[model samples]
Target: MQILIVDDNNPVLEHIQSLLIERGFESVTASNGLDGLEKAQQSHYQLIIIDHLMPIMNGFQLAKNLRQNPNTAQTPILFMSTQDIGVIKNTAEAALVNALITKPIDENEFISHVYRLLDQNTQHQSL
Candidate 1:
């Protein structure tokens, strides 16, 4: 499955990309929200892992935009940010992201969340 990862930090982007790759997952990346939105428009992704703070557009904007686009309306999103989890959680339902993950992420939990979202998508598709 293909995943899109958007983060302003180069190291974080590389680390997440590496982790996903090691798990045998294909991933595409963008440095900021605007670029990520452009990439999202160009392809179908099983899931998107996006950072909350970014240039041009933020994660909330990105999620709102994605929801408005028919092609990506049902795509699952995982929000990763350094912000408070409660704040992120509060906006998640409105933004339509499937889950919120905090920064300095725990690798195992991140992977678990990824699989859970993808699995849920798969199950939804089958239904």
Candidate 2:
């Protein structure tokens, strides 16, 4: 599956990319939300993993833009943030995020969410 990872932190971006690559998943990355949106428009992604806080644009704004674009409207989005999940839960849901993953990423949980989202995408495509 092809995944897009958007984060300002270089190490975190590389870590997630490496993890996905090691597991045989292809990933593309962007330094911030605006860059991410441009990349998203340029290509196709089965899922998107984005950080909540960024310089160019925030994850919530990015998700809102994605929802407005027909090509990305139904694509699953996963947000990674250091912020409290409960604090942003309602906003994330309102923005149409499929899941909100807390950072300092748990390998098992992260991979599980990735696989689950991909499986869901696959099922929808088959239908």
Q: Highest lDDT, which number?
A: 1
lDDT of 1 by residue, 25-106 (tens): 9999999999999999999999999998899999888988998999999999998989888866765344578888899899
Worst 10 residues of 1 by lDDT: 87-96
Whole-model lDDT per candidate = 0.92, 0.91
What clash count goes with each model? 0, 0
Cα deviation at 121, candidate 1, in Å, is: 0.6
* TM-score for each model: 0.95, 0.95
lDDT of 1 at 3: 99
Screening candidate 1 with a backbone cut-off below 3 angstroms (N, C-alpha, C), the clashing residue pairs are: none
lDDT by residue (18-97, candidate 2, tens digit) is 99999999999999999999999999999999898999799988999998999998899988989898888866354579
- Deviation in angstroms for 97 in model 2? 0.4
